[model samples]
Target: MQSFAKPRALEPLRPLAVHLPSMSYVDVKMRWKKDASFDAVPVLSRARDLRPLVSLARLLSPSPTPVSVVSKLRSSLETPDRRVTSFLRRFPAAFVESVGPEHNLPWFRLPDAAVHLLREERDVFAAGRADVTGRLRRLVLMCPRRRLPLRVAQGMLWHLGIPEDYFKDPDHDIAQDGFRILTSGDGVTCQDDDGRELGLIGDGKGKEMPLSVLQLNAMRKFGSVAKVPVPLFQSKGLRLKRKIQDWLEGFQRLPYVSPYEDFSHINPGSDVSDKRAVGVLHELLSLFVTCSAERRRLLCLRKHLGLPQKFHLVFERHPHVFYLLLKEKTCYVVLKEAYMAGGDTAIEEHPMLKVRKKYIELMEQSQEIIRCRRNRKPIELQSMVSCSGDIEDCTEILS
Candidate 1:
């Protein structure tokens, strides 16, 4: 038998120190640029305002709810009763006003069309349980310890297309695939089994590592995996200044790093590090069913993802990939691919989107209702209110 030579002592890995020219350290405030096409994207534009309506609809799903009961939800909805009531009245097609049987107070209930649509939404959630869990799993895998706090996951339920009952149901299927929920004195956490090296979109065993939306787009356009994809400006007149454009071009030329890969080797504040940061944001947004998220919501993820203090600036720096929409005094970061060039819609539309479109159709009826009401035509108003299923009661309110 051949004797094996003694192996040399293993050395501890050290962090790499990257050095660059002094100019790279200059601090520049990147001004936010607006894009009309992205602002006009239907889903991103309306989802914020519709969220309150949807939440109230779900609350009233079980039975007609009184204004007093809805008013108590001020803290939950983050808006006062007046605002909530105003919003409810704006959508006559989706919500019907009635008097409570017991208290005779103003009550709200879903219209028949809204009820049927909500039922279909539930069916969609049930059928897509596996997909929702998969998205959650991917999110946890991106964490440093393959663990994610329960509160964070809960916050993401709406964007992930998960039903509100998911966590409350102990028998839910989330515990099926190498995932478990651990409870302790601190709080609840969702963790995956150790030693599993899952990629963003695929397992590492595959020949091709999972590529981000940007990478795939680059490959398609360049016929190879280019480090930087050609940026698509939303507006014809919009243009980047020479200095900023040059800096962006230089930043784009940096080597691309996958979000799922090891990031410890990257140097902080370097161009490579910025690329990794961008990759992380891209992957995180891609996991969402809507491919968009509120900027404030994403701040909760920074510490867990090893992102810089000002990671949000990436959205401003990379307008081609991300779009920042300032609406209702809240900033929403939208992944452009989802709305442009037949991205998410071209591949497969999320079931929630179908429900949303139906809700939009229902909302359109409100315009007609308002038009009829403005004309002070009792005949048309009566006919419309009758169609709402509570003509006798709502007619007085509408008038």
Candidate 2:
């Protein structure tokens, strides 16, 4: 009979004391260098030292859960020292990347590429890219050599299954409701050749625009990233829009009859029902925000990429139509569904709708897939993660 005993505990987990170097230890080995903006180099350096311990914990300990890491994290936070926090964070990132494929699939591959292209276009216009990159990317880019999250995005794209290069002058404009608008170029908002970013807006029309201007418009932290493509090009018809939307609905298994879209305007003196409708609408907006991205948010961002539970609808421009805008990178999506729900054909009736909330589980848990190769995990096309986030009622590219 084979003996499958505990085997005298292969390796007992050690207190993380030796896991991190003492302050004097670090001081002797390294000095802080002042960078232009952020001073994360030191943190990175510390991560290198602690990494061996973490890897050891993984290999030798009975179990080294994220929870255990979290406990050590709390200890680091409480300690007078701060090196521990950095080690805890970077270690998890490394672990996530290391285990992503072994644990799960990734999105953001080829099949998913079409949606990402569209999203790239949307962010390029509605806001800019780098600004978004700053705020959302932090959480998503956890691992050094990562693949799980991006794989999820790629897989869904394949599963949601759309064509490649769909954003290059898309053949569908049906969603525009019979109108055409286009963006200028990718460089305008960028810091390079053109000037549409960093408050450059445009020279003369686009002047000193860097990457930050979009931050001002998008109202996001990195809104300053100036490079984005916000021009709207007219396509053949609404076929593209219809096809894309239809595909998403089927792919996501969303319900056709939206009860909330209907009752928000009824205002029948019933606060309870109104609130419920509001909640549902809010979910829809989040869905819209993330959905449009396809899998961009999940590909590069995970934590900070969520819809605000609170927002405002301002009738600043188009009369009778209020703008469902976010505080930063303020966005507005089509209010057609809401209008139709309210039994009002007048496009100008309800200009905007606002909502905010807590439970982002649905929007966050959209879909994701991960593919694996030997050393490097290959993110497949069908991988997907929910692209749901805050959505706005954005008009056409040219409105």
Candidate 3:
């Protein structure tokens, strides 16, 4: 067994080197990066989590899709009627409305800037399709059946730079051998290597993918080894074995503070301590599921993370790094860079996303059944029998 040395003393907590109150948000963000802890979290956008934002953009992409049409489209994703209305009201600058072709119906269209944003997303995806295909193949390989749910899969399309319309085309086969659709009493699911049923997807119970050993430790390690006070400089000569040893040495150095250590002693009124707390919090968040944490949930951990009770202010002070989404009556703090557009894009495929896509696709089929129920009035017995047959045939195709 390898022997480990005792951990070194933790560095004394100090106020930020400079006052952030006088600095702009951008400057504060830039200065925060100078600290070794900047962006320690691996933030990634959850398209499903941000469905209201994404579905709205897609609904209004090409032209003014009718408000009714947009509602129907959003319904496929299980977006609530109130959420749709509220989302529109909250972001008035991104949307505008006009009369539909029928003259009485109102149609919604994205503003010029929003339209341009969609175009940029399209252009980026087109350029990166090959890159996405390779990553997607690897994702399927890791899963048991190479199958995933459509609900979860849809979110990843945006993250992987895959065209939203790609699946609509029967002829386009990027990973034909690795991906497919399955229909069951529950709903439509995607399969790769076709016959394998890995039991990765099921009722709400199986929705969460199994957590990896690496991910589980990422956040926990921060509180264990982040406060060493080695000279804040990189060594040019260190290589492989020595480099690993250096890392071990760094963690064991004097001035240690586990991210989990209590922060009640930190001077909350001082700008410096506040900044350090913010950086630590941000890094802690990176390890969270979905790269997001509910505001209330974070508040509950205030003592454990050494955060102030009014920790919400830290997000406001760094608008460029964090996005606060107020939806479903809960406030969610999302890392801005984890979303689609950023200096480092989400080109990497995620297993959790691959699994969820199937569920979303199943939801799509359920929505179709709902639409059929709502649209069908009284029909003759013979016609009703024929309609049921058609539904069965359609289900097979969707599967």
Which of candidates 2 and 3 is the stronger one according to TM-score?
A: 3
What TM value does model 3 have? 0.37
Off by over 4 Å in 2: 1-97, 100-164, 167-315, 333-340, 343-362, 365-399
Write candidate 1's Cα lDDT for 1-399 as tens digits. Answer: 976998799997665544333224334445567777766666777767566766777778546777777776766775423557777788877888888788677788887767776777787777876666666676766676555666666788788777765667776655554455554522433242332222223222343335556666677667677554434445445667788777777766778877656688777767777778877887788777678888999998887778889998888777777888898788899877667756422223566666665566566667667776788854232223233322233332344
Show the colliding residue pairs in model 1: none
Task: Please report the candidate that would top TM-score against the real structure.
Answer: 1
Q: What C-alpha lDDT, on a 0 to 100 scale, does residue 364 get in candidate 2?
A: 20
Worst 10 residues of 1 by lDDT: 195-204
* C-alpha lDDT values of all predictions: 0.66, 0.25, 0.45
Mind giving the per-residue lDDT tens digits that candidate 3 earns over 1-399? Answer: 876988899997778966454312221221122221222321322233345555577767547767775565555555544556545544433556667778677667775545554555555555654555544433333333444445444444544446556666675554442455455533544342343222222322333332222223333444332343211122223233454445335333423233433345555565545555555554444443355656665553454345667777777555445656654465667654445334333223333342233223323433454454467732221111121112122212211
For model 3 the local lDDT of residue 341 reads 32
For candidate 2, the per-residue lDDT at 179 reads 18
Give the runs in model 3 whose Cα sits over 4 Å from its true position: 1-50, 61-63, 78-86, 99-105, 149-161, 176-399
TM-score of each: 0.77, 0.16, 0.37
- Once superposed on the true structure, which residue ranges of model 1 sit more than 4 Å away at CA? 1-30, 79-83, 101-104, 185-210, 218-234, 343-348, 378-399
Worst 10 residues of 2 by lDDT: 350-359
